[model samples]
Target: MTKTLALIAAAVLALPLAATAQSSTDAKPAAKAAAKPAAKPAPKKKPQVTRRAAKAVEEVTPIDTSTDVTLNEADLAVAGRVHTGKIQCELGADVTVTADESKPGYFTVSTKGAKYRMHPVESRTGAIRLEDPRAGAMWLQLGNKSMLMNQKQGLRLADDCQAPAQVAMSAELKLNPPKSLFEGADAPTSGPVKK
Candidate 1:
């Protein structure tokens, strides 16, 4: 039994040596296969594409200045009332309004980097309103002040803008301080009151 056990141990140790020798021989064959150049693949036929002649494209007129807004007499009247030249506003900012000689009832409103072609728009409040529909900007001229607003941005670009006339009007309003609509409404009417 001891002799058998000794033989079994010897066979187990020899098994590892055999596996190492087999792996070395297998590696040499794999290395030789990698050293040999691989066969090149045949070129593939590409799909054919048909070419068409280019078609002439019509010139596209830009929509910014192309808008032909015909102003009525009322709108023109409002335009005439629009204060021209540079108007000072709050925060030391100024806006310039210039009437276009070529196009009546149209004015260019510019401040710093922005410039817009605006036209008078009728307002229910009796204020002179100029609008640039393309740029979504509006200039509102009131009795005592004017303002530039960006409708798209939902904020006023310039507020408390005053021209020469507006400055005087503003001072007058401060001095007189127009009476509110409800000032005398609460008081009894001059007519005989029913007891």
Candidate 2:
């Protein structure tokens, strides 16, 4: 019985060594096959730019300041408000919105002389939206004549008020207004003045 058990243990130990020798012989052929250099990939071709396409690129000009830029009301209504709206918020605060004529994508929202510049952003739904990222506020245009203003602190306002056209500043006043700080004062002297 002892002799038989010893033979079984020796056979079990020898089995792993035989399998390892067989795997090593099998791996040599695979390693020799992998040692050969792989075939090189074909070089890529560059796209040709034709002269007409180059001329098409050169013919593109920047926005010309010489031409007058006008804002269409219908497009403005869909994207942003063309005119300003005076809103009374639920927090009992009065807010004023001034649409930028030169840049139709921006608006100025003012409250008690404090102004905030807001940019138009794509809304989740079909509503027109203006967002003030600094203040974490959003203004949604509900209809052609009404707007809903929302703040992060849960303050909301429904505004339908519109200011009269006369309240708008004239083009002359808006373009070249007098300087506020040094209207009457001369330029500061460079050094101490002589007696």
Candidate 3:
């Protein structure tokens, strides 16, 4: 029984070495098999794209500026608050500010002395070209509202002029603001309301 056990141990130890030796021998054939010839690539067929006729692009004519830019009063919606001395009114105009919206027929309005580029209907744009020939008045469009500030006050109203307009911020004999943002138009009244 002792001899049998010793024989079994020796066989177990030798079995590992024998298995390793056999693997080494087997690896040679595997290595040779790995040295296989390169496979040939398949040929690709050519695309059958046919050429079509060129498109006929016509030149777009420029808008006629010779005449007045037709402004649609129905489209213009004034949405802003206008205050003068003790007078105030809410201008509910829906203006646009989206890019790529070419609002033709829209005229830039100038009231009192302020100016801003009037937007077209459905444009959703906000631009105040507050430079008009009208004196004693200021026009500005904030967001979607067109505000017209005047220099007139009633009995009950002290003043409703907007902030000292930048254009006339300086120049003492400046116009009296109806609702002066700094103070009442009378705060820096150079003289009586000229008109």
Candidate 4:
């Protein structure tokens, strides 16, 4: 009877240990499943555009490929009033650039007391461009107006302001002239004398 009782007790103790071992083994698989990384979703493919839709879109936007534009001397002449806002200078002043395109291929630019003679140079655009190498200045003519830029000083004067009245060269001369040489009657005479 004692032998049978001892065998039963041993089996009872082994039952809890076996249950724990089985539970731990089962939990290992669950833990591994939770730790596994999820698979990535497949990349989405772009929807194909119908041929009719592409043709309709192309018809809506037309491309211009004409290259017949030309710029001539007349286009570059600074004839009309061209003015700009206050120029950023040392004294912070406004400047007026007057161009006389009377002479082809050559033009005169006047601002304040300074005058620059410019000549046309090759430009890649339709705008007429003139340059004064001496002063390092450039004049870009756009339609009826022009802009003056100083390359050396890195200054730009746009043709956005209202130009003042055109100053006549003759009027300026009339206003200010040199002192009269023949002030008195003792004027020097130069001529061929007949004996």
In order of appearance, the predictions have TM-scores of 0.60, 0.34, 0.18, 0.31
1 against 4, candidate with superior TM-score: 1
Residue 174 C-alpha lDDT in model 1: 76
The residue pairs found clashing in candidate 4 are: none
How does residue 30 of candidate 3 score in lDDT?
A: 74
Models sorted by TM-score, best on top: 1, 2, 4, 3
Off by over 4 Å in 2: 1-77, 80-93, 144-150, 157-195
Report RMSD (Å) for each prediction in the order shown. Answer: 37.3, 32.9, 37.7, 41.7
Which tens-of-lDDT digit does each residue in 111-156 have in candidate 4? 5555566666554333445667777676664433345666556655
User: For residues 1-195, could you state the per-residue lDDT of candidate 2 as single tens digits?
Assistant: 335545544554465588689889899786877878755644644433322222222122111222233435644565544346775544456678887787876788776635666665543334445666666555554332334344444444544432343223323445755354225444545887555
Residue 127 in model 3: lDDT: 34
Order of the predicted models by lDDT, top scorer first: 1, 2, 4, 3
Segments of candidate 1 deviating more than 4 angstroms: 1-66, 185-195
> Which model, 1 or 4, shows the larger lDDT?
1
Predictions in order: lDDT: 0.70, 0.50, 0.32, 0.46
The digit string of per-residue lDDT tens for model 3 on 1-195 reads: 335545544553465588689989899787877789645544644421110000000001111223333445543443122211222323322222221235533334333333334333222122332221223233443322234433221011111223334223323324542342224123333667544
Query: Native-vs-model 2 lDDT?
Result: 0.50
